[model samples]
Target: MAEKEKQEDYRVEIGGDDSKRSYTPAPAPSVSNSPTMAILSYCGASILMTLTNKYVLSGYDFNLNFMLLAIQNIICVVAIQGAKSMGSISYRDFKMDEARKWFPISLLLISMIYTGSKAIQYLSVPVYTIFKNLTIILIAYGEVLWFGGSVSRLTLFSFGLMVLSSVVAAWADINAAISSYGHDASETATALSTLNAGYIWMLVNCLSSAAYVLGMRKRIKLTNFKDFDTMFYNNLLSIPVILLCSLFLEDWSSANIDRNFPSAQRNNLIIAIIFSGLSSVFISYTSAWCVRVASSTTYSMVGALNKLPIALSGLIFFDAPVTFPSVSAIAIGFVSGLVYAMAKVKQQKVATTSLPVSSASSASMRDGLKN
Candidate 1:
């Protein structure tokens, strides 16, 4: 998930029919076209978080996905409170009104993470990484309709390539998996399933994740939430709902507990859960920061773009098939990301740079009219 926070001080100028507002950057010395550092921060934290999640879920011994989420939320809340006490970061104490407002977004986040865990349990990491790019289209158009954002033609072309890459990756993954059952016609027929359970969960995850990001982006601006506030509220408000689900949906017997946290791997599991929680603070902050400083589409694009390394790493570490078609698909994604980034930079530069000239002209005309 992502949110927009612009790096430069900018204002919306209302003009034209029906009071349509335009999002143009104000004339400022530090009118950066993009939040390069925030993008980097998100990429780093997001990748670390994803890899660790995959590691913990890879074995599927942990049956309770929501329980795991609850643990992480608990740790993150504790860490944030500790940091607040230490004066490292500060946010408004939990207000009922604000929590009421933020609760829907938290639910969306829970749906996204839970569905993602379900999907990732069955899908290869590389396929999951590539398919995530599909959310960019939804976000770009969502921004256009709801946030007064626009997508350039170059960006559209890049989107097409991204879609193609996902198709290729999915096809290659299925083919490689099916090849393992060669020389058996019955098995081949049975294994020809494309829309499996994992893919269904992945689709749900994509929709939920997109909704969460878009909703959070709009809500944060409306509420004037700082990054820390978003981080705190999302993690904090989610615990009760998650625990409630865990209560109903998960096993709590001592035998199940031992199975979930076996004695030998218990140390590793504890550390991973703690690390995931610690990193959530960073990931949440960076995600909100990126969306605020950048457009929602740009935030989504940059996150997917940065996944070039993630796709490759998933392939390397997860031992997914290293086929020619899969490699080419990754290459296509990389090139499209470059094209999209360049186009966004050019668009922002023109929009921001032209504002000063237009503002100056308006000012001069007003002075002449006064005289």
Candidate 2:
């Protein structure tokens, strides 16, 4: 009798049934956090936009950039719907019903307009293109300082490389201006201006973009919204903000609508419009997705990839002179930026894998005992 009782007790402990017991597996991590594919799309979009702007829209004046942005946002809406129909995840799960969620989106749209306009106005095409890398450095430091996270040494090295590459890429332009305009002439004085008026605008762009990323991260974590939902809301909020800014700041009454262009120019403008629109959609979506999957530092470094192609295209299309020093700088920057991005990815992967699973098993045992 005693032996039988002991056996029964052992069975109860193992099976958790005699008194009560149960088993429950922990919920798996959501797939939404893995956004590598999205990051690639963002990088691709950057390259496409650079190509179009350089080769196709050189002489067009139909507000092609604005038109492309509008079209891209529309396409983003369509893409979200498509994602939903395919039974992929969406933002509906977040349960957010407040109007306040749209604020950050509006800020982003305003920043884009201001930055784009200012870049065209004050900086040479090459300078504007190269300075964009500054955004990466700003974002990386912002994340570390504001979020209380430490940046890895590899990441810092990568940022240094990117900054170096950017300076090198602009070297050819700087040298040419010095040679043609004479190193000490007043007429050429503006050409040698470093971080001129337009650069200030780009700095604003960097800060606004950082705000968007940081704000959106907080919002998503709090609400548990899907990527598509966040994107949709952001785009929707941007429309009115863009329109309002255009009305007050831009000279809408003097807007030109003529399509007059040489046959070749017209063809190029058409190509630019299509490519720009596609790129806008790709970059906007992928960037947000990247922030969700990886740290801001990683995303920022990935953004620097645009400089390589942009610099090369400037040389090929505009006959921008390339020098040995400039070339070396570009190579160094690209390698460093790549290294930083790889390190970030490794860190994110480790973080995901480190999640505890034992708690779920304990909960299951307790439930079984209660039953």
Model 1: CA > 4 A from native: 1-41, 183-195, 285-302, 354-371
Task: Please report the candidate that would top TM-score against the real structure.
Answer: 1
lDDT of each: 0.73, 0.56
For candidate 2, lDDT tens digit of each residue in 1-371? 99666555554333545756533444466656666765676666666666555453344543444444555556666666677778864555323463376566557655665565555444445555666655556655665676545557776777677677667756755676677779569756776663355566767766765555555555555655554566666666666666555556544443343443456566666666666656656665666666668655455445655566665665666644566765676567667657765766665555558853222211111111110
Could you list the CA RMSD of all candidates, in the order they appear?
12.8, 11.6
TM, every model: 0.78, 0.66
Q: Which pairs in model 1 have colliding backbones?
A: 3-291, 3-292, 4-291, 4-292, 5-291, 5-292, 5-293, 6-292, 6-293
* Alpha carbon RMSD to native, model 1: 12.8
* lDDT against true structure, model 2: 0.56
Report clashes for each candidate as comma-separated counts.
9, 6
The clash tally of candidate 1 reads 9
320-356, model 1: which lDDT tens digit per residue?
A: 7899988977888787777766666566566667653
